[model samples]
Target: MRVLFVAAELAPFAKVGGLADVAAGLPPALARLGLDVRVAIPKYRAIGERAQDFASAGTFPVTMGGKDLTCSVSQGIIPASDVPIYFLGHDPYFDRRGIYGEQNEEYPDSLARFAFLSRAALGLGPALGWLPDVIHANDWHTALAPVYLRAGAVDLMSRSVLTIHNLAYQGWFPIDQAAAVGLNEAGRKLVASGRQLNLLRGGIQAADWITTVSPTYAEEILTRGEGLEDALQARRDSLTGILNGIDTSVWDPSTDPHLWAPYSSTDLAGKVVNKRALQEALGLAPTAAPLLGMVSRLAEQKGFDLLLVAFERMMAFGIQFVLLGEGDARYASFFRDAEQRYPGRVRALIEFSEPWAHRIEAGADIFLMPSRFEPAGLNQLYSLRYGAVPVVHATGGLKDTIRECDPVHDRGNGFLFAEYTAEAMLEAVGRAIRLWRTDPEAWRKLVARGMAEDHSWNRPARQYCAVYERVVAR
Candidate 1:
């Protein structure tokens, strides 16, 4: 199968969140499965190095808003792989300081920017003389791709697959602005709602197949579909939720150079060395108390709203806490205060550093994820690989991946709390702590179980291939 995967972010080149990692990891996995896969992303100015290495694939016209805008194409290879990736070079739209915004503010012309991206991605294949059989568009950024294809504006017979990363963000815009996306009258009606135009709604209705990050998350979207619950429920039979897999090659603890010392499930002595190193590096008092680490955006969706309340309650557990991420001013202020209040026990770095993230995964005894509504989480998978037991809210992918630690039978991998309240989460955390303080053998078994499980992209990639085949067959 010839597949063209399109997304707004591609790691090492342009990355804003988990979507970048998915764009980076999935195509290569699909390539390994004996499929011809290529990737396309906007050539943004934020993508440092200017992508000068990419060979030009000539120019093409993308019609949108009743105007034919010219876009140049550049072809390059995915880092560490032979997958041919393409870039849509349009200085007016993508040449900006940020991928989606500047200083947390989204670009006002985001609708036009991404709509151009969708149409340009469709034209890229023919510009390079490599038309794909399947066009896989990701998230709200490229949601209009399927819409244009359905309108037959593009002269391709290929099927399209739209993957919803987060249902909360559907790119709702003024109905007047919807004309800029280059959809025909018939296609426009599908996405129009009251006075707004829902880009994702159109894609969901037009795409041959739909997928989300995780199986449980897939089901959750039926009711938790933000504002489009009815549309999702109508398409429930076609939507498949496949759990996302991390890039084991990059996330593997045994070989990661960012850690103080490499460690595996078999030899945990290095884990102790890493813990002390990280504690000292972060200026936290080095103690035998279990070190709990969290690396995520400190936004409301990530459960910072709940963590703010749970912070004081968790301090009583006598565990050292370390957080590394940047989001929400309220959460940042709170953590900064907590760090000062508990000088020796708490350390919060309100920033995003890749090296620190890897170090936290490798060094911390327990990893924390308390998302309010997670579609699919990547850090828990990283934690599992690094032998860091996870204490996550039992929702979406967290519910699918983590199993409660069975202290009696030694059966589960980590701790889970079903209720969204802080007390429920603390109860789960208390259980993990009790096992860590009382039973060393049980703790080791729990860590070993998580570490031993394969969370690589190979399986998920195969599952995607099945979806693509089914789409093609239909």
Candidate 2:
């Protein structure tokens, strides 16, 4: 089966989040599973000028605002994979320093930018004679792919699947701009009083199947829109959630080149070397203290406020803390103050470094991910692979991925706190610290068990292939 993936970002090219990771990893896994899969994304500044293995396909004319606009198409082979990647390059929209907007705000021309991309993707299927069996679209950026396929002019034989990585970002455009993007009369009628063009809603309404990242998240979107219009509830039968999986090769601690020492379930004594190295890197005193580390976007939704509250109390307990990320100003300032307050105990890195992130996963004794609502986090899975015990709030993928330790049996992966309160977070941290300080045998078991579990994309990829087969069969 031939599958075409339409997404805004792909790994090592233009990645701002997990969506890019999925776009790059899942398709390659599917290709290895004997399906022909290809990726299509807009050419942004981060992708650089010359694309590897990229060859010009001449200019294709696209109409916007009743005027013709020609976009250049370039094709490249995805590194270490048999799948092909197609890029739609145009100067006006995507030639910027960042993938999204400069600040937290969305780009003003985002609607027109991605609208062209979606239309171009559908238009290319016939032009290039590569008619896919299914077109899988991700997020609001590529939400118009389904709508484009449903257009009468496009003789699209492919069924479309829409995956909502996060329901928070629905592409809202002016009602006047709807016609420019090929929104039909019926679609326009469904708009609310604002008459805004809700691209995600249209895609969810138009697609043959709709999926989110987790089962809990899928259920959560029903009553709570999360920017997904009430139409989410209307299309209840079609919507489903499939939890995400990590690429084990990228996250494995046993062979990770970034680690100070390589260690696995069998030989976990080397984990201490990584821990010491992490302590040194964070400017903490090289003591045998338990370290709690976090690598996430510093935003309110990630429960940073609660983390601050917990940390204020946690500082009295004498545990080391390290953080690495770049996000909102308020959180950054808060962490800055904390860094000054506890110089040797707390360290915060305001950047996104992949290698350093890997080191954190390999080294930290405890990983904290207290997200208010996480769709499907990859870090907790990565932490498990590294034998770094996770102390996470029981919500979304955290609940799905991390198994809570049975105090009686002593046979689980990590610690799980049910409530999203600061007290609950501190309690969970205290539990992790107690385990580290007191229970040697249980700590060894937790580390061993966490390392033994599988969180690879292999299983999830097969499940996706099954979903593809089912959708095609229908």
Candidate 3:
């Protein structure tokens, strides 16, 4: 079966968050199952080589705002896979520095930009004479793909599947702009929310199937849908929450070139070497304290505020802390100040480095994820593979993936805090620290248990294929 993936970001090309990783990981896994899968994304300026390496697949015209505009198409194969990736070029709209916006300010023309992407993605298939049986749209950026499909914007009759990565970001625009994007009169009437047009709602209503990143997240959004809970409630039967999987090759500690020393669940001596290296490199004293680390976008949703409050109490435990991420100016400034307040105890790298991320996962004794609400976190999964021993808030995928450590049996993988509070977080960390300082054998068993578990895309890929087959049958 031929399936087309419409997304705004693709890993190693254009990326902003976990969605990019999902876009890059899932397609290749699906292709291995003998399914003909193709991905389509906008040709942002950030996509290096300027399309010089891609094969020009000619051009197609997308009529928007009653105007027929031509769009250039370039095609290339995903690295190390047979899956084809199509790049849709519209220089005036997508040729910008940042993918979404700058300094927490989204591009004013985001609606028009992504609207063109949805229309262009639909047009890309017929232009290349390789129409797909199903079109899988991701997030609000490509949410309009389902709306366009239902409106018959293209010649092909493709089933549509919309995946809501995070419901917090529903593309809201002035209802007046709907006509410019060619939102049909019927769709406009249904998706209009007071004087606003919600792009995600439009897709949720139009798509044949809807999915969220995790099973727990799928259930949580029903009542806490930001503003569209009612809309989601109306279509509960169609929604499914599929847990996301990580790219084991990229996150594997045994072969990770980013690590100071390679280690596995079998021999954990290299973990100690990497941990000492991490402490020395980050300017922390090489003490016997348990090194705590986190690598996440420093946003409110990621529980940065809670971490700030919890950090003061956590310091009393004599644990070293390290953070690697870049987001929210406020959070960045606080962490920068933290380095001064606790010299040799705290290190916050205000940048996003893939190699550093891998190294941190391999080295840190305990990985912290205090997210208030997470859809499906990849870091926690990566931490498990690297034997970082995650101490995450028990919500969403974290609740589903992480099990509370059973000291009696030493069976469970990680620690979890049920409540979303600073004290709750500290208590969970305290449990892990106690395990580390007292019972070293049990700690090793817990870490090894997490490492032995499978979090690869092989299972998620098959789950997605089943969804695709169901939609096609309908």
TM-score of each: 0.98, 0.96, 0.98
lDDT of 2: 0.83
For model 1, what is the error of residue 316's alpha carbon versus the real structure, in angstroms, after optimal superposition? 1.1
Candidate 1 lDDT, tens digit per residue, 181-215? 67778778877878988989988988889999999
Model 3 TM-score, 2 decimals: 0.98
Compose the digit string of candidate 2's lDDT tens values, residues 1-474. 999999999887888888988887888888889998989999887664665547776668776557678777888867778788888878788888878888777788888899888877777676677799999999988878887666543567899899999888788878898777665675554432266887888788778789888887888778777755478887888888788887777777777888889898999878888988888877898978888889998888788989878777887778888889999988888888898999898889988999989988888889999999888888888888888899998888888888888756967899988888999998988898998888888898888888898777787788788778888999
Residue 203 lDDT (model 2): 83
- Where does candidate 2 stray beyond 4 Å? 151-153, 189-193, 227-229
**Shift in Å, residue 424, candidate 2:** 1.1
Candidate 1 Cα deviation (angstroms), residue 307: 1.1
Question: Model 3, which residues run further than 4 Å from truth?
Answer: none
> Residue 465's C-alpha lDDT in candidate 1?
97
As a whole number from 0 to 100, the lDDT of residue 79 in candidate 2 is 73
